[model samples]
Target chain A: MEQYEKIYLYKRIVKAKLFIDDHYAENIDLGNICDQANFSRFHFIRLFKSIYGSTPNNYLIKTRMEKAKILLAKGHSVLETSIMVGFDSPTSFAGMFKRIAGQTPSSFQKKQHAQKNAMQLNPLLFVPNCFAENNGWTK
Target chain B: MITKITHTCIYVLDQNSAYDFYVNKLGFKVHTDAPMGEGARWLTVTPPEQPELEITLFLVAEGGMFDEETVQIMTTLIKKGTFGAAVFTCKDLLATYEELKSKGVVFKKPPTKEFYGYEALFLDDSGNWFSLAQINS
Candidate 1:
């Protein structure tokens, strides 16, 4: 491919990725993503996988799960989080979350809640020792 | 007095991947790509709009340019993402940020309004981060 063509292709591929980044909360699929990039399904999958190192569906699921993690950490219930991140069923959400995050939704939320409470109790305890000492905060 | 600084170096973990990141992702053009004996390459690239400056993509291999210990330490430091080597200016911070992010550039910061300018930070393939800024003039 010519240099300009390569640049154009990359711009299109990046556009598809940005679309996924923006609309991961929506019901997105291979067709929607490929439309954003102007590529056919199989060819788009090839290009997207080569560049981003994951298929579009996997990337979409990962994106939603990542946002779900933040929402879960912020004390949102698993059912609510699943809905928020566009998951239809909490069971599927919990299953996928466990697969990707290595813990059940409730357990992760509990850990985050415990950590938040502990931090609130002694804010300094959560601060890294080196970071505190760097500004003479330890002394 | 020196007329201009033409060349600089960024120590990379793997030269081929760095080439892909710089040329394919960042739209830099390869200025020089050649072998310097013993399976090492003397590779350099230039930003698309700035051909005058050659950014040498020096490989951190333990052979001719460095010893085994030095290579180990350098790789460790680069992997830790410690270096902030250069500042690249862009016309529009937000657009460039989005564009680069799509190309898999790992950004450390989103564009924010600092006193000096609107600046964001991103890491290259080999873990050397850069400051992408749009100065308020």
Candidate 2:
């Protein structure tokens, strides 16, 4: 496994996490993920957990579920939503959904849509460019 | 000699959302989208002005870092949203804060005095924390 001071190693782990985020929906597997972070299959898992506190699969599942919720709210059918998130079967998606989201996909989607009105930032919000003025030149 | 830190990573449930948040909202430039065999993607980010430097984001679940046991632990923290932090050097901390706030970036804490200089904290869409600071040149 690669070694750096804790700080330097952490920065590398972060870089890997970013890669996962950009392509989670695109059929990711373990070997490729480990390679991206420049770690072996054995070591990458431990270091990634130490740094980001989650296994790669869980992150991928959660990401898929999150997207599933959004698609459901948009009125996509349960089966469609299931496939959209990469689950081959709606049953599998439902089972996973129950485990993670605590409710059936349809129910969650119904509840979400029932909310009074959708605000521009209702689902989620990002930190605005509050630091633009201070952002200095790149190193 | 090693150059300054070029890239940083943040775990995300899905990469598309991460891309939207970082590129669309945070205004980071996408530096790399290399392919790792087996359907995985390698993504990176950098300040718009410094396109050459890139930070890669890896997708690891709670205990999935190295194997199943670890994935359990790591996924928990990642789901709860407490993992790591990204530090950005700023020329003027105050101005950056105001600009980010205007763009709808949420801040956990306002800028405050620190040994390094003025600093502020914010969270990305993935619940990863980041710091913005103005350091002496």
Candidate 3:
């Protein structure tokens, strides 16, 4: 019985993760998440928490923020990146970024540039790999 | 027409750790490490000469498409080291199983003959369930 519960829990976790990875940039709600994992809302929440230390809401935010950071680094504007990550309003997006990342989008981009500069300062950071040798994207 | 698979993406917290498991432990070859955006790394790999299909290594953070609850589940599973799974085609399933065993790869089940070929289950470093299949030639 306990083993079955364990397996059930495992499957739900996998499903939930899949839902997040696939739809992290969309408008997601608790009911939708539960439905995607094929679990009751109450059971899904409990099992999710038991397996993952954080709540579902926190995970979504983190995933979006991480994506935003990447997009920002890639030269996308704050508004563009915000919309790309499914934020309804730029203000809300900025607020969330400030809270979670401790900076606004512009500041984060600045930091990224600084970090890139520092990496360039270290010659060993740019060691050319044979696999990426011909790929235009890496260069 | 049965076209080749281009890529499959796996989200992870640590890129280097995942790379170690896929490349060093599982014997996959690193095919490319393209810069994705900002701090994100787009590391890809293939099996031997099978460079046509590559796996994308993605790093997960907070927000975006997933609500707080969904991220919690994925993060939890990833932390517990039981995230996802893959199927790798091998030249010799039985021999490969033995070799993986020598490398301390644990198996939940032994290889058995299926209509398609020989199949066996092994957990990746993060507890992703993957099967090794080698067709009888």
- Native A-B interface contacts kept, per candidate: 0.06, 0.00, 0.00
For model 2 the TM-score comes to: 0.45
Ranking by lDDT: 1, 3, 2
Tens digits of per-residue lDDT for model 1, B1-137: 88987878898999989999998788687665644335655577888669889898878877645789999999999989988889998765665776988678999998888999899999999899999998886
TM-score of each: 0.53, 0.45, 0.48
Chain A TM-scores, one per candidate? Answer: 0.91, 0.71, 0.80
Off by over 4 Å in 2: A1-8, A116-139, B1-137
lDDT preference between candidates 1 and 3, better one: 1
Residue B132 alpha-carbon offset, candidate 3, angstroms: 19
For candidate 3, write residues A1-139 as lDDT tens digits: 9956755556556567557756988999777788877888777777666545467777778778978987888789999999989799999999999999899999999887776665445422332343233322244
lDDT of each: 0.81, 0.66, 0.71
Model 2 interface DockQ = 0.03
Q: Please, what are the lDDT tens digits per residue for candidate 3 over residues B1-137?
A: 97767777676767888888787667676655545345545577777548677776655654333567777788788767674457777765554665567567878778888999889988766556777887766
**Which tens-of-lDDT digit does each residue in A76-102 have in candidate 2?**
999988887778789999999989989
lDDT of 2 at A50: 54
Best by TM-score: 1
